[model samples]
Target: MDPLSPVYITGCGAFLPGQPIDNEIMEDHIGRVGGAPSVFGRRALRWNGIARRHYALTPEGRWLHSNASMSAEAVLRALEAAGLGRADLDCLAAATTQGDLLVPGHASAVHGELGGGALELASFQSVCASALMAAKYAWMAVRTGEANCAAACAGEFSSRWFRPEFYEGGALIDTKGRLAMAADFLRFTLSDGAGAVVMESRPRPKGLSLRVQWIDMVSLAGRFDPCMWAGASEQGRAERDGGWSRRGPLAAHAEGAIALQQDFNLLKAVIRAWIGVYLDKVDAGRIDPRAVDHLLCHYSARSLREEIVGLLEATHAMIPEERWFTTLTETGNVGSASIWIMLEALVRSGRVQPGQRILCIVPESGRAMVGFMMLEAVEAVR
Candidate 1:
């Protein structure tokens, strides 16, 4: 693929409802919501790097924004930033695991919220890496001449999926002594947010735009079951006696250790493959890891990020610590929206200058897929 073939990002936007809520607020609400009150939520917050997060619902438990509504807001802002309108959009690609319904899809939900249109629509259920996957698909569409311009968006409403009962249900007798339930551990880390980007086939001559240099995605579904899952286990179902459990919890089974078991080797293989694809560039003295100005990564957790970073550095990729960035502490883990949200924040922060390079990686717990994208900033007008 040509580096300057256009299929670049022209605009980006994000929607985070309400103000930042600390662990204190979250604990207070958790205490009143369901089952028994436990300190797991607060403990999870302390264990993770998250100090605060944005929630779509009020602390007192009022519904504020649904997935569709938040996504619509983000899409509108992105279109406006691109100097385009809804009618100008040729395609709308959405990626999300949590939507209003399981049938019509989140893409359809967002499309309907945008007022039914004839644009090409697609919905992806790629878990945490969904938005990045959507972006990759949109880039492919533009590169293949299927669409002149497309919007890739993702909306995540994690608040609704959390089950307070699950948090207080399980008790750990292990040495760690932490909550044995996934809900207890994940409640404080997951958050609600939406983010989007507008990509065009034609690159702007003078402005901040991300050119699609290269993208690679690989899924390891067959190799591992999802560490995080939403449905109930067979053991749980049978224990409950053929009926449904209202507070069906989303489980994060083994946490980071399971992912680390294979990622170290997988990442090495990915690096080798990347070198092979760009070997010509490297031979011609056009490739340099030190030239990478930014490392935008998915917000899984602080420890996981550190382990990955260590691996990257050990592999002779000299990624500067200051240049590496994420939104784990400020926004929690917005799942699929994490990638786009981090990108939007970086763009708005004005840290990325013209001609700089950015390398982003999306790591999902479910299916254990890793997506890689390398892009170059063209120009900065603002």
Candidate 2:
């Protein structure tokens, strides 16, 4: 393969486990903490605007699929859509917020579940931008002639963390007799799913292909404290004594450190940071806001949509509302898997035409990181 050849995303696949759980019935599945419904769940559900979402668990809160299994299923579907098989891939890249095991990397776990010949592998762990980072790695592998065919995937088994058992006998209520935001916020927002994309040196023989133009990623951790995190106390006490490992496991669990937490106070800063990054990209000539035919943004919640739009317009880097695409309301926030799932849906909608440009933006509030990718839809080389 020529080193100068362009890399194309020939196929995309997404797998959302189990049936769609409606907002009214969510407590029935995940169960109510403290043997009663949370007072904040209804308000949170309304604010997030997520009507339905899928989970990798049954009504009794028993897990039905592991993160690796879901990722493998998506990979198989992507390979099939690309008219290829597992043996055809030369590289596999995977991303997730957390895997089933803390020892082996997520890519290794996915590869083990996929069960094919040996291949190059990479794993990424972060909030929302992890999937795009994995895609960037796969694209580089194909573009640099290091591989002929590559697949990048992201999966989230977030439902496991939201189950009531995780919070059993823990302090979840505040002084007002309501569930604390730190423990209650994510329960209504997150869901479980996986998505994958196949990239190759050449486009498919007879269909639309997304030619990779550029992928840019940046981290602004220096400017912000941890906004979303787990495995540590919300007060940041663990950091002063080395880290979470310094605290005994029982102590950490009793302090509710193992549960996911978000600092809602920092959300505005996070959105502003995302807009600033977009403005920087425009100023550097890396992107033209007006030329973007489609904009897929992973904002994690519908409540932030207006704020993001306002910021974009204020910064003069606005892509019109008509050009925006999102599935947050229907799919909930699947963290790192969201962008890939959105891309797969857009490509399958049959609305894209040759020469169309699709821009993807992923903002991660975990220490404020963001990723942007641009792709041009092209006709396959027949």
Candidate 3:
């Protein structure tokens, strides 16, 4: 195995739970937060421009699929597409914001659910960049000859938190009788799904494979506070004595210490930080925007997309509007799974051609993290 061996994405698969839930029927699945429709939810839906999304819950809001199960299913599909069995894998890496169990890691749970021979496993827990980090690990493993075949997958089960029952006993509305903006904003924007990819040192025998050109990630946490988080009552409290762990389980739950929160005020800073990283990559000659045939960017909302466009144009690094591709409106924001799902959709669409380069950009506002991956479509080796 050559140290400089190129890693190829041999297969891509996605598992979107349940049917496409339209905007009108969203509440029917997630239910109203305070026993009634939320005005904030309605406005957020219109602004986010997500027409439909999937949820791992039924109309009754009961559990339909756990995070681990979804990731396993996606990995199985990816393995099938790669023409490999579970026994062929040397490493399994998974990423997610959270899993059903708190003790075992997400990758371990996915491996147990997948049921295969013992293999090296890695789990990444963060915001959206988790998936890219997992993919980078698999790519490095294959490139370094540490693994002949590796799989990286991401799953997001955010619908459970969006459910009204999750916040039933908590004070969801302010004293003005309005739902909290942070909580309501995400309910309409985030959804559930999982995506997986199989990576190997060589391309597949009879299909298109994306050769991994490079993967770069940057974190700006030192200059920014947490923009999106959970399992904490306040920004810096998660590390202090006032953290969620300090409060008893029941007390924490009752006080809404576990709710997913976002600071909209920091969104502009997130965009700027992401662009700064991109500029650095460009300056280092690692990326040439004009060489990218397709741009797959994971923007949480349409508004954010516009902001990104403005910055790209201002910096003269724009990839052109026509070259950009996204499934956000149709799939919503799947967090760690968004980039994988978008790539899977583009590959499955039959639009990509051999030798075309696809650039992927994923920005995470958990503390302003950004990931960039470049892939080149190549014909399968005979």
Clash totals for all models, in order? 0, 0, 0
CA displacement after TM-score superposition, residue 310 of candidate 3 (Å): 1.2
Native-referenced Cα lDDT, model 2: 0.88
Clashing pairs in 3: none
Residue 145 lDDT (model 1): 84
Candidate 1 ranges beyond 4 A from true positions: 1-5, 30-39, 163-180, 234-288, 380-382
lDDT of 1 by residue, 64-134 (tens): 98899899889988888777888888888999866878688888889888885688888998677777788
User: What's the TM-score of each model vs. the native?
Assistant: 0.80, 0.96, 0.96
> Per-prediction RMSD in angstroms?
6.3, 1.8, 1.6
Candidate 3's error at 380, in angstroms? 1.2
- Writing each residue's lDDT as its tens digit, candidate 3 over 1-382 gives 5558899999998999999999998987888766778878878887788999999988787889999999999998898888988889889999999887887899999999998688999999999999999999999999988999999999999999887777766655565455578778988889999999999999999899999988988898888878888776654433666556778767776666678878898877878888888888888888888899999989899988888888778776778999989999899999999998999999998999999999999999899999999999999888
Candidate 2 regions off by >4 Å?
1-3, 173-178, 237-242
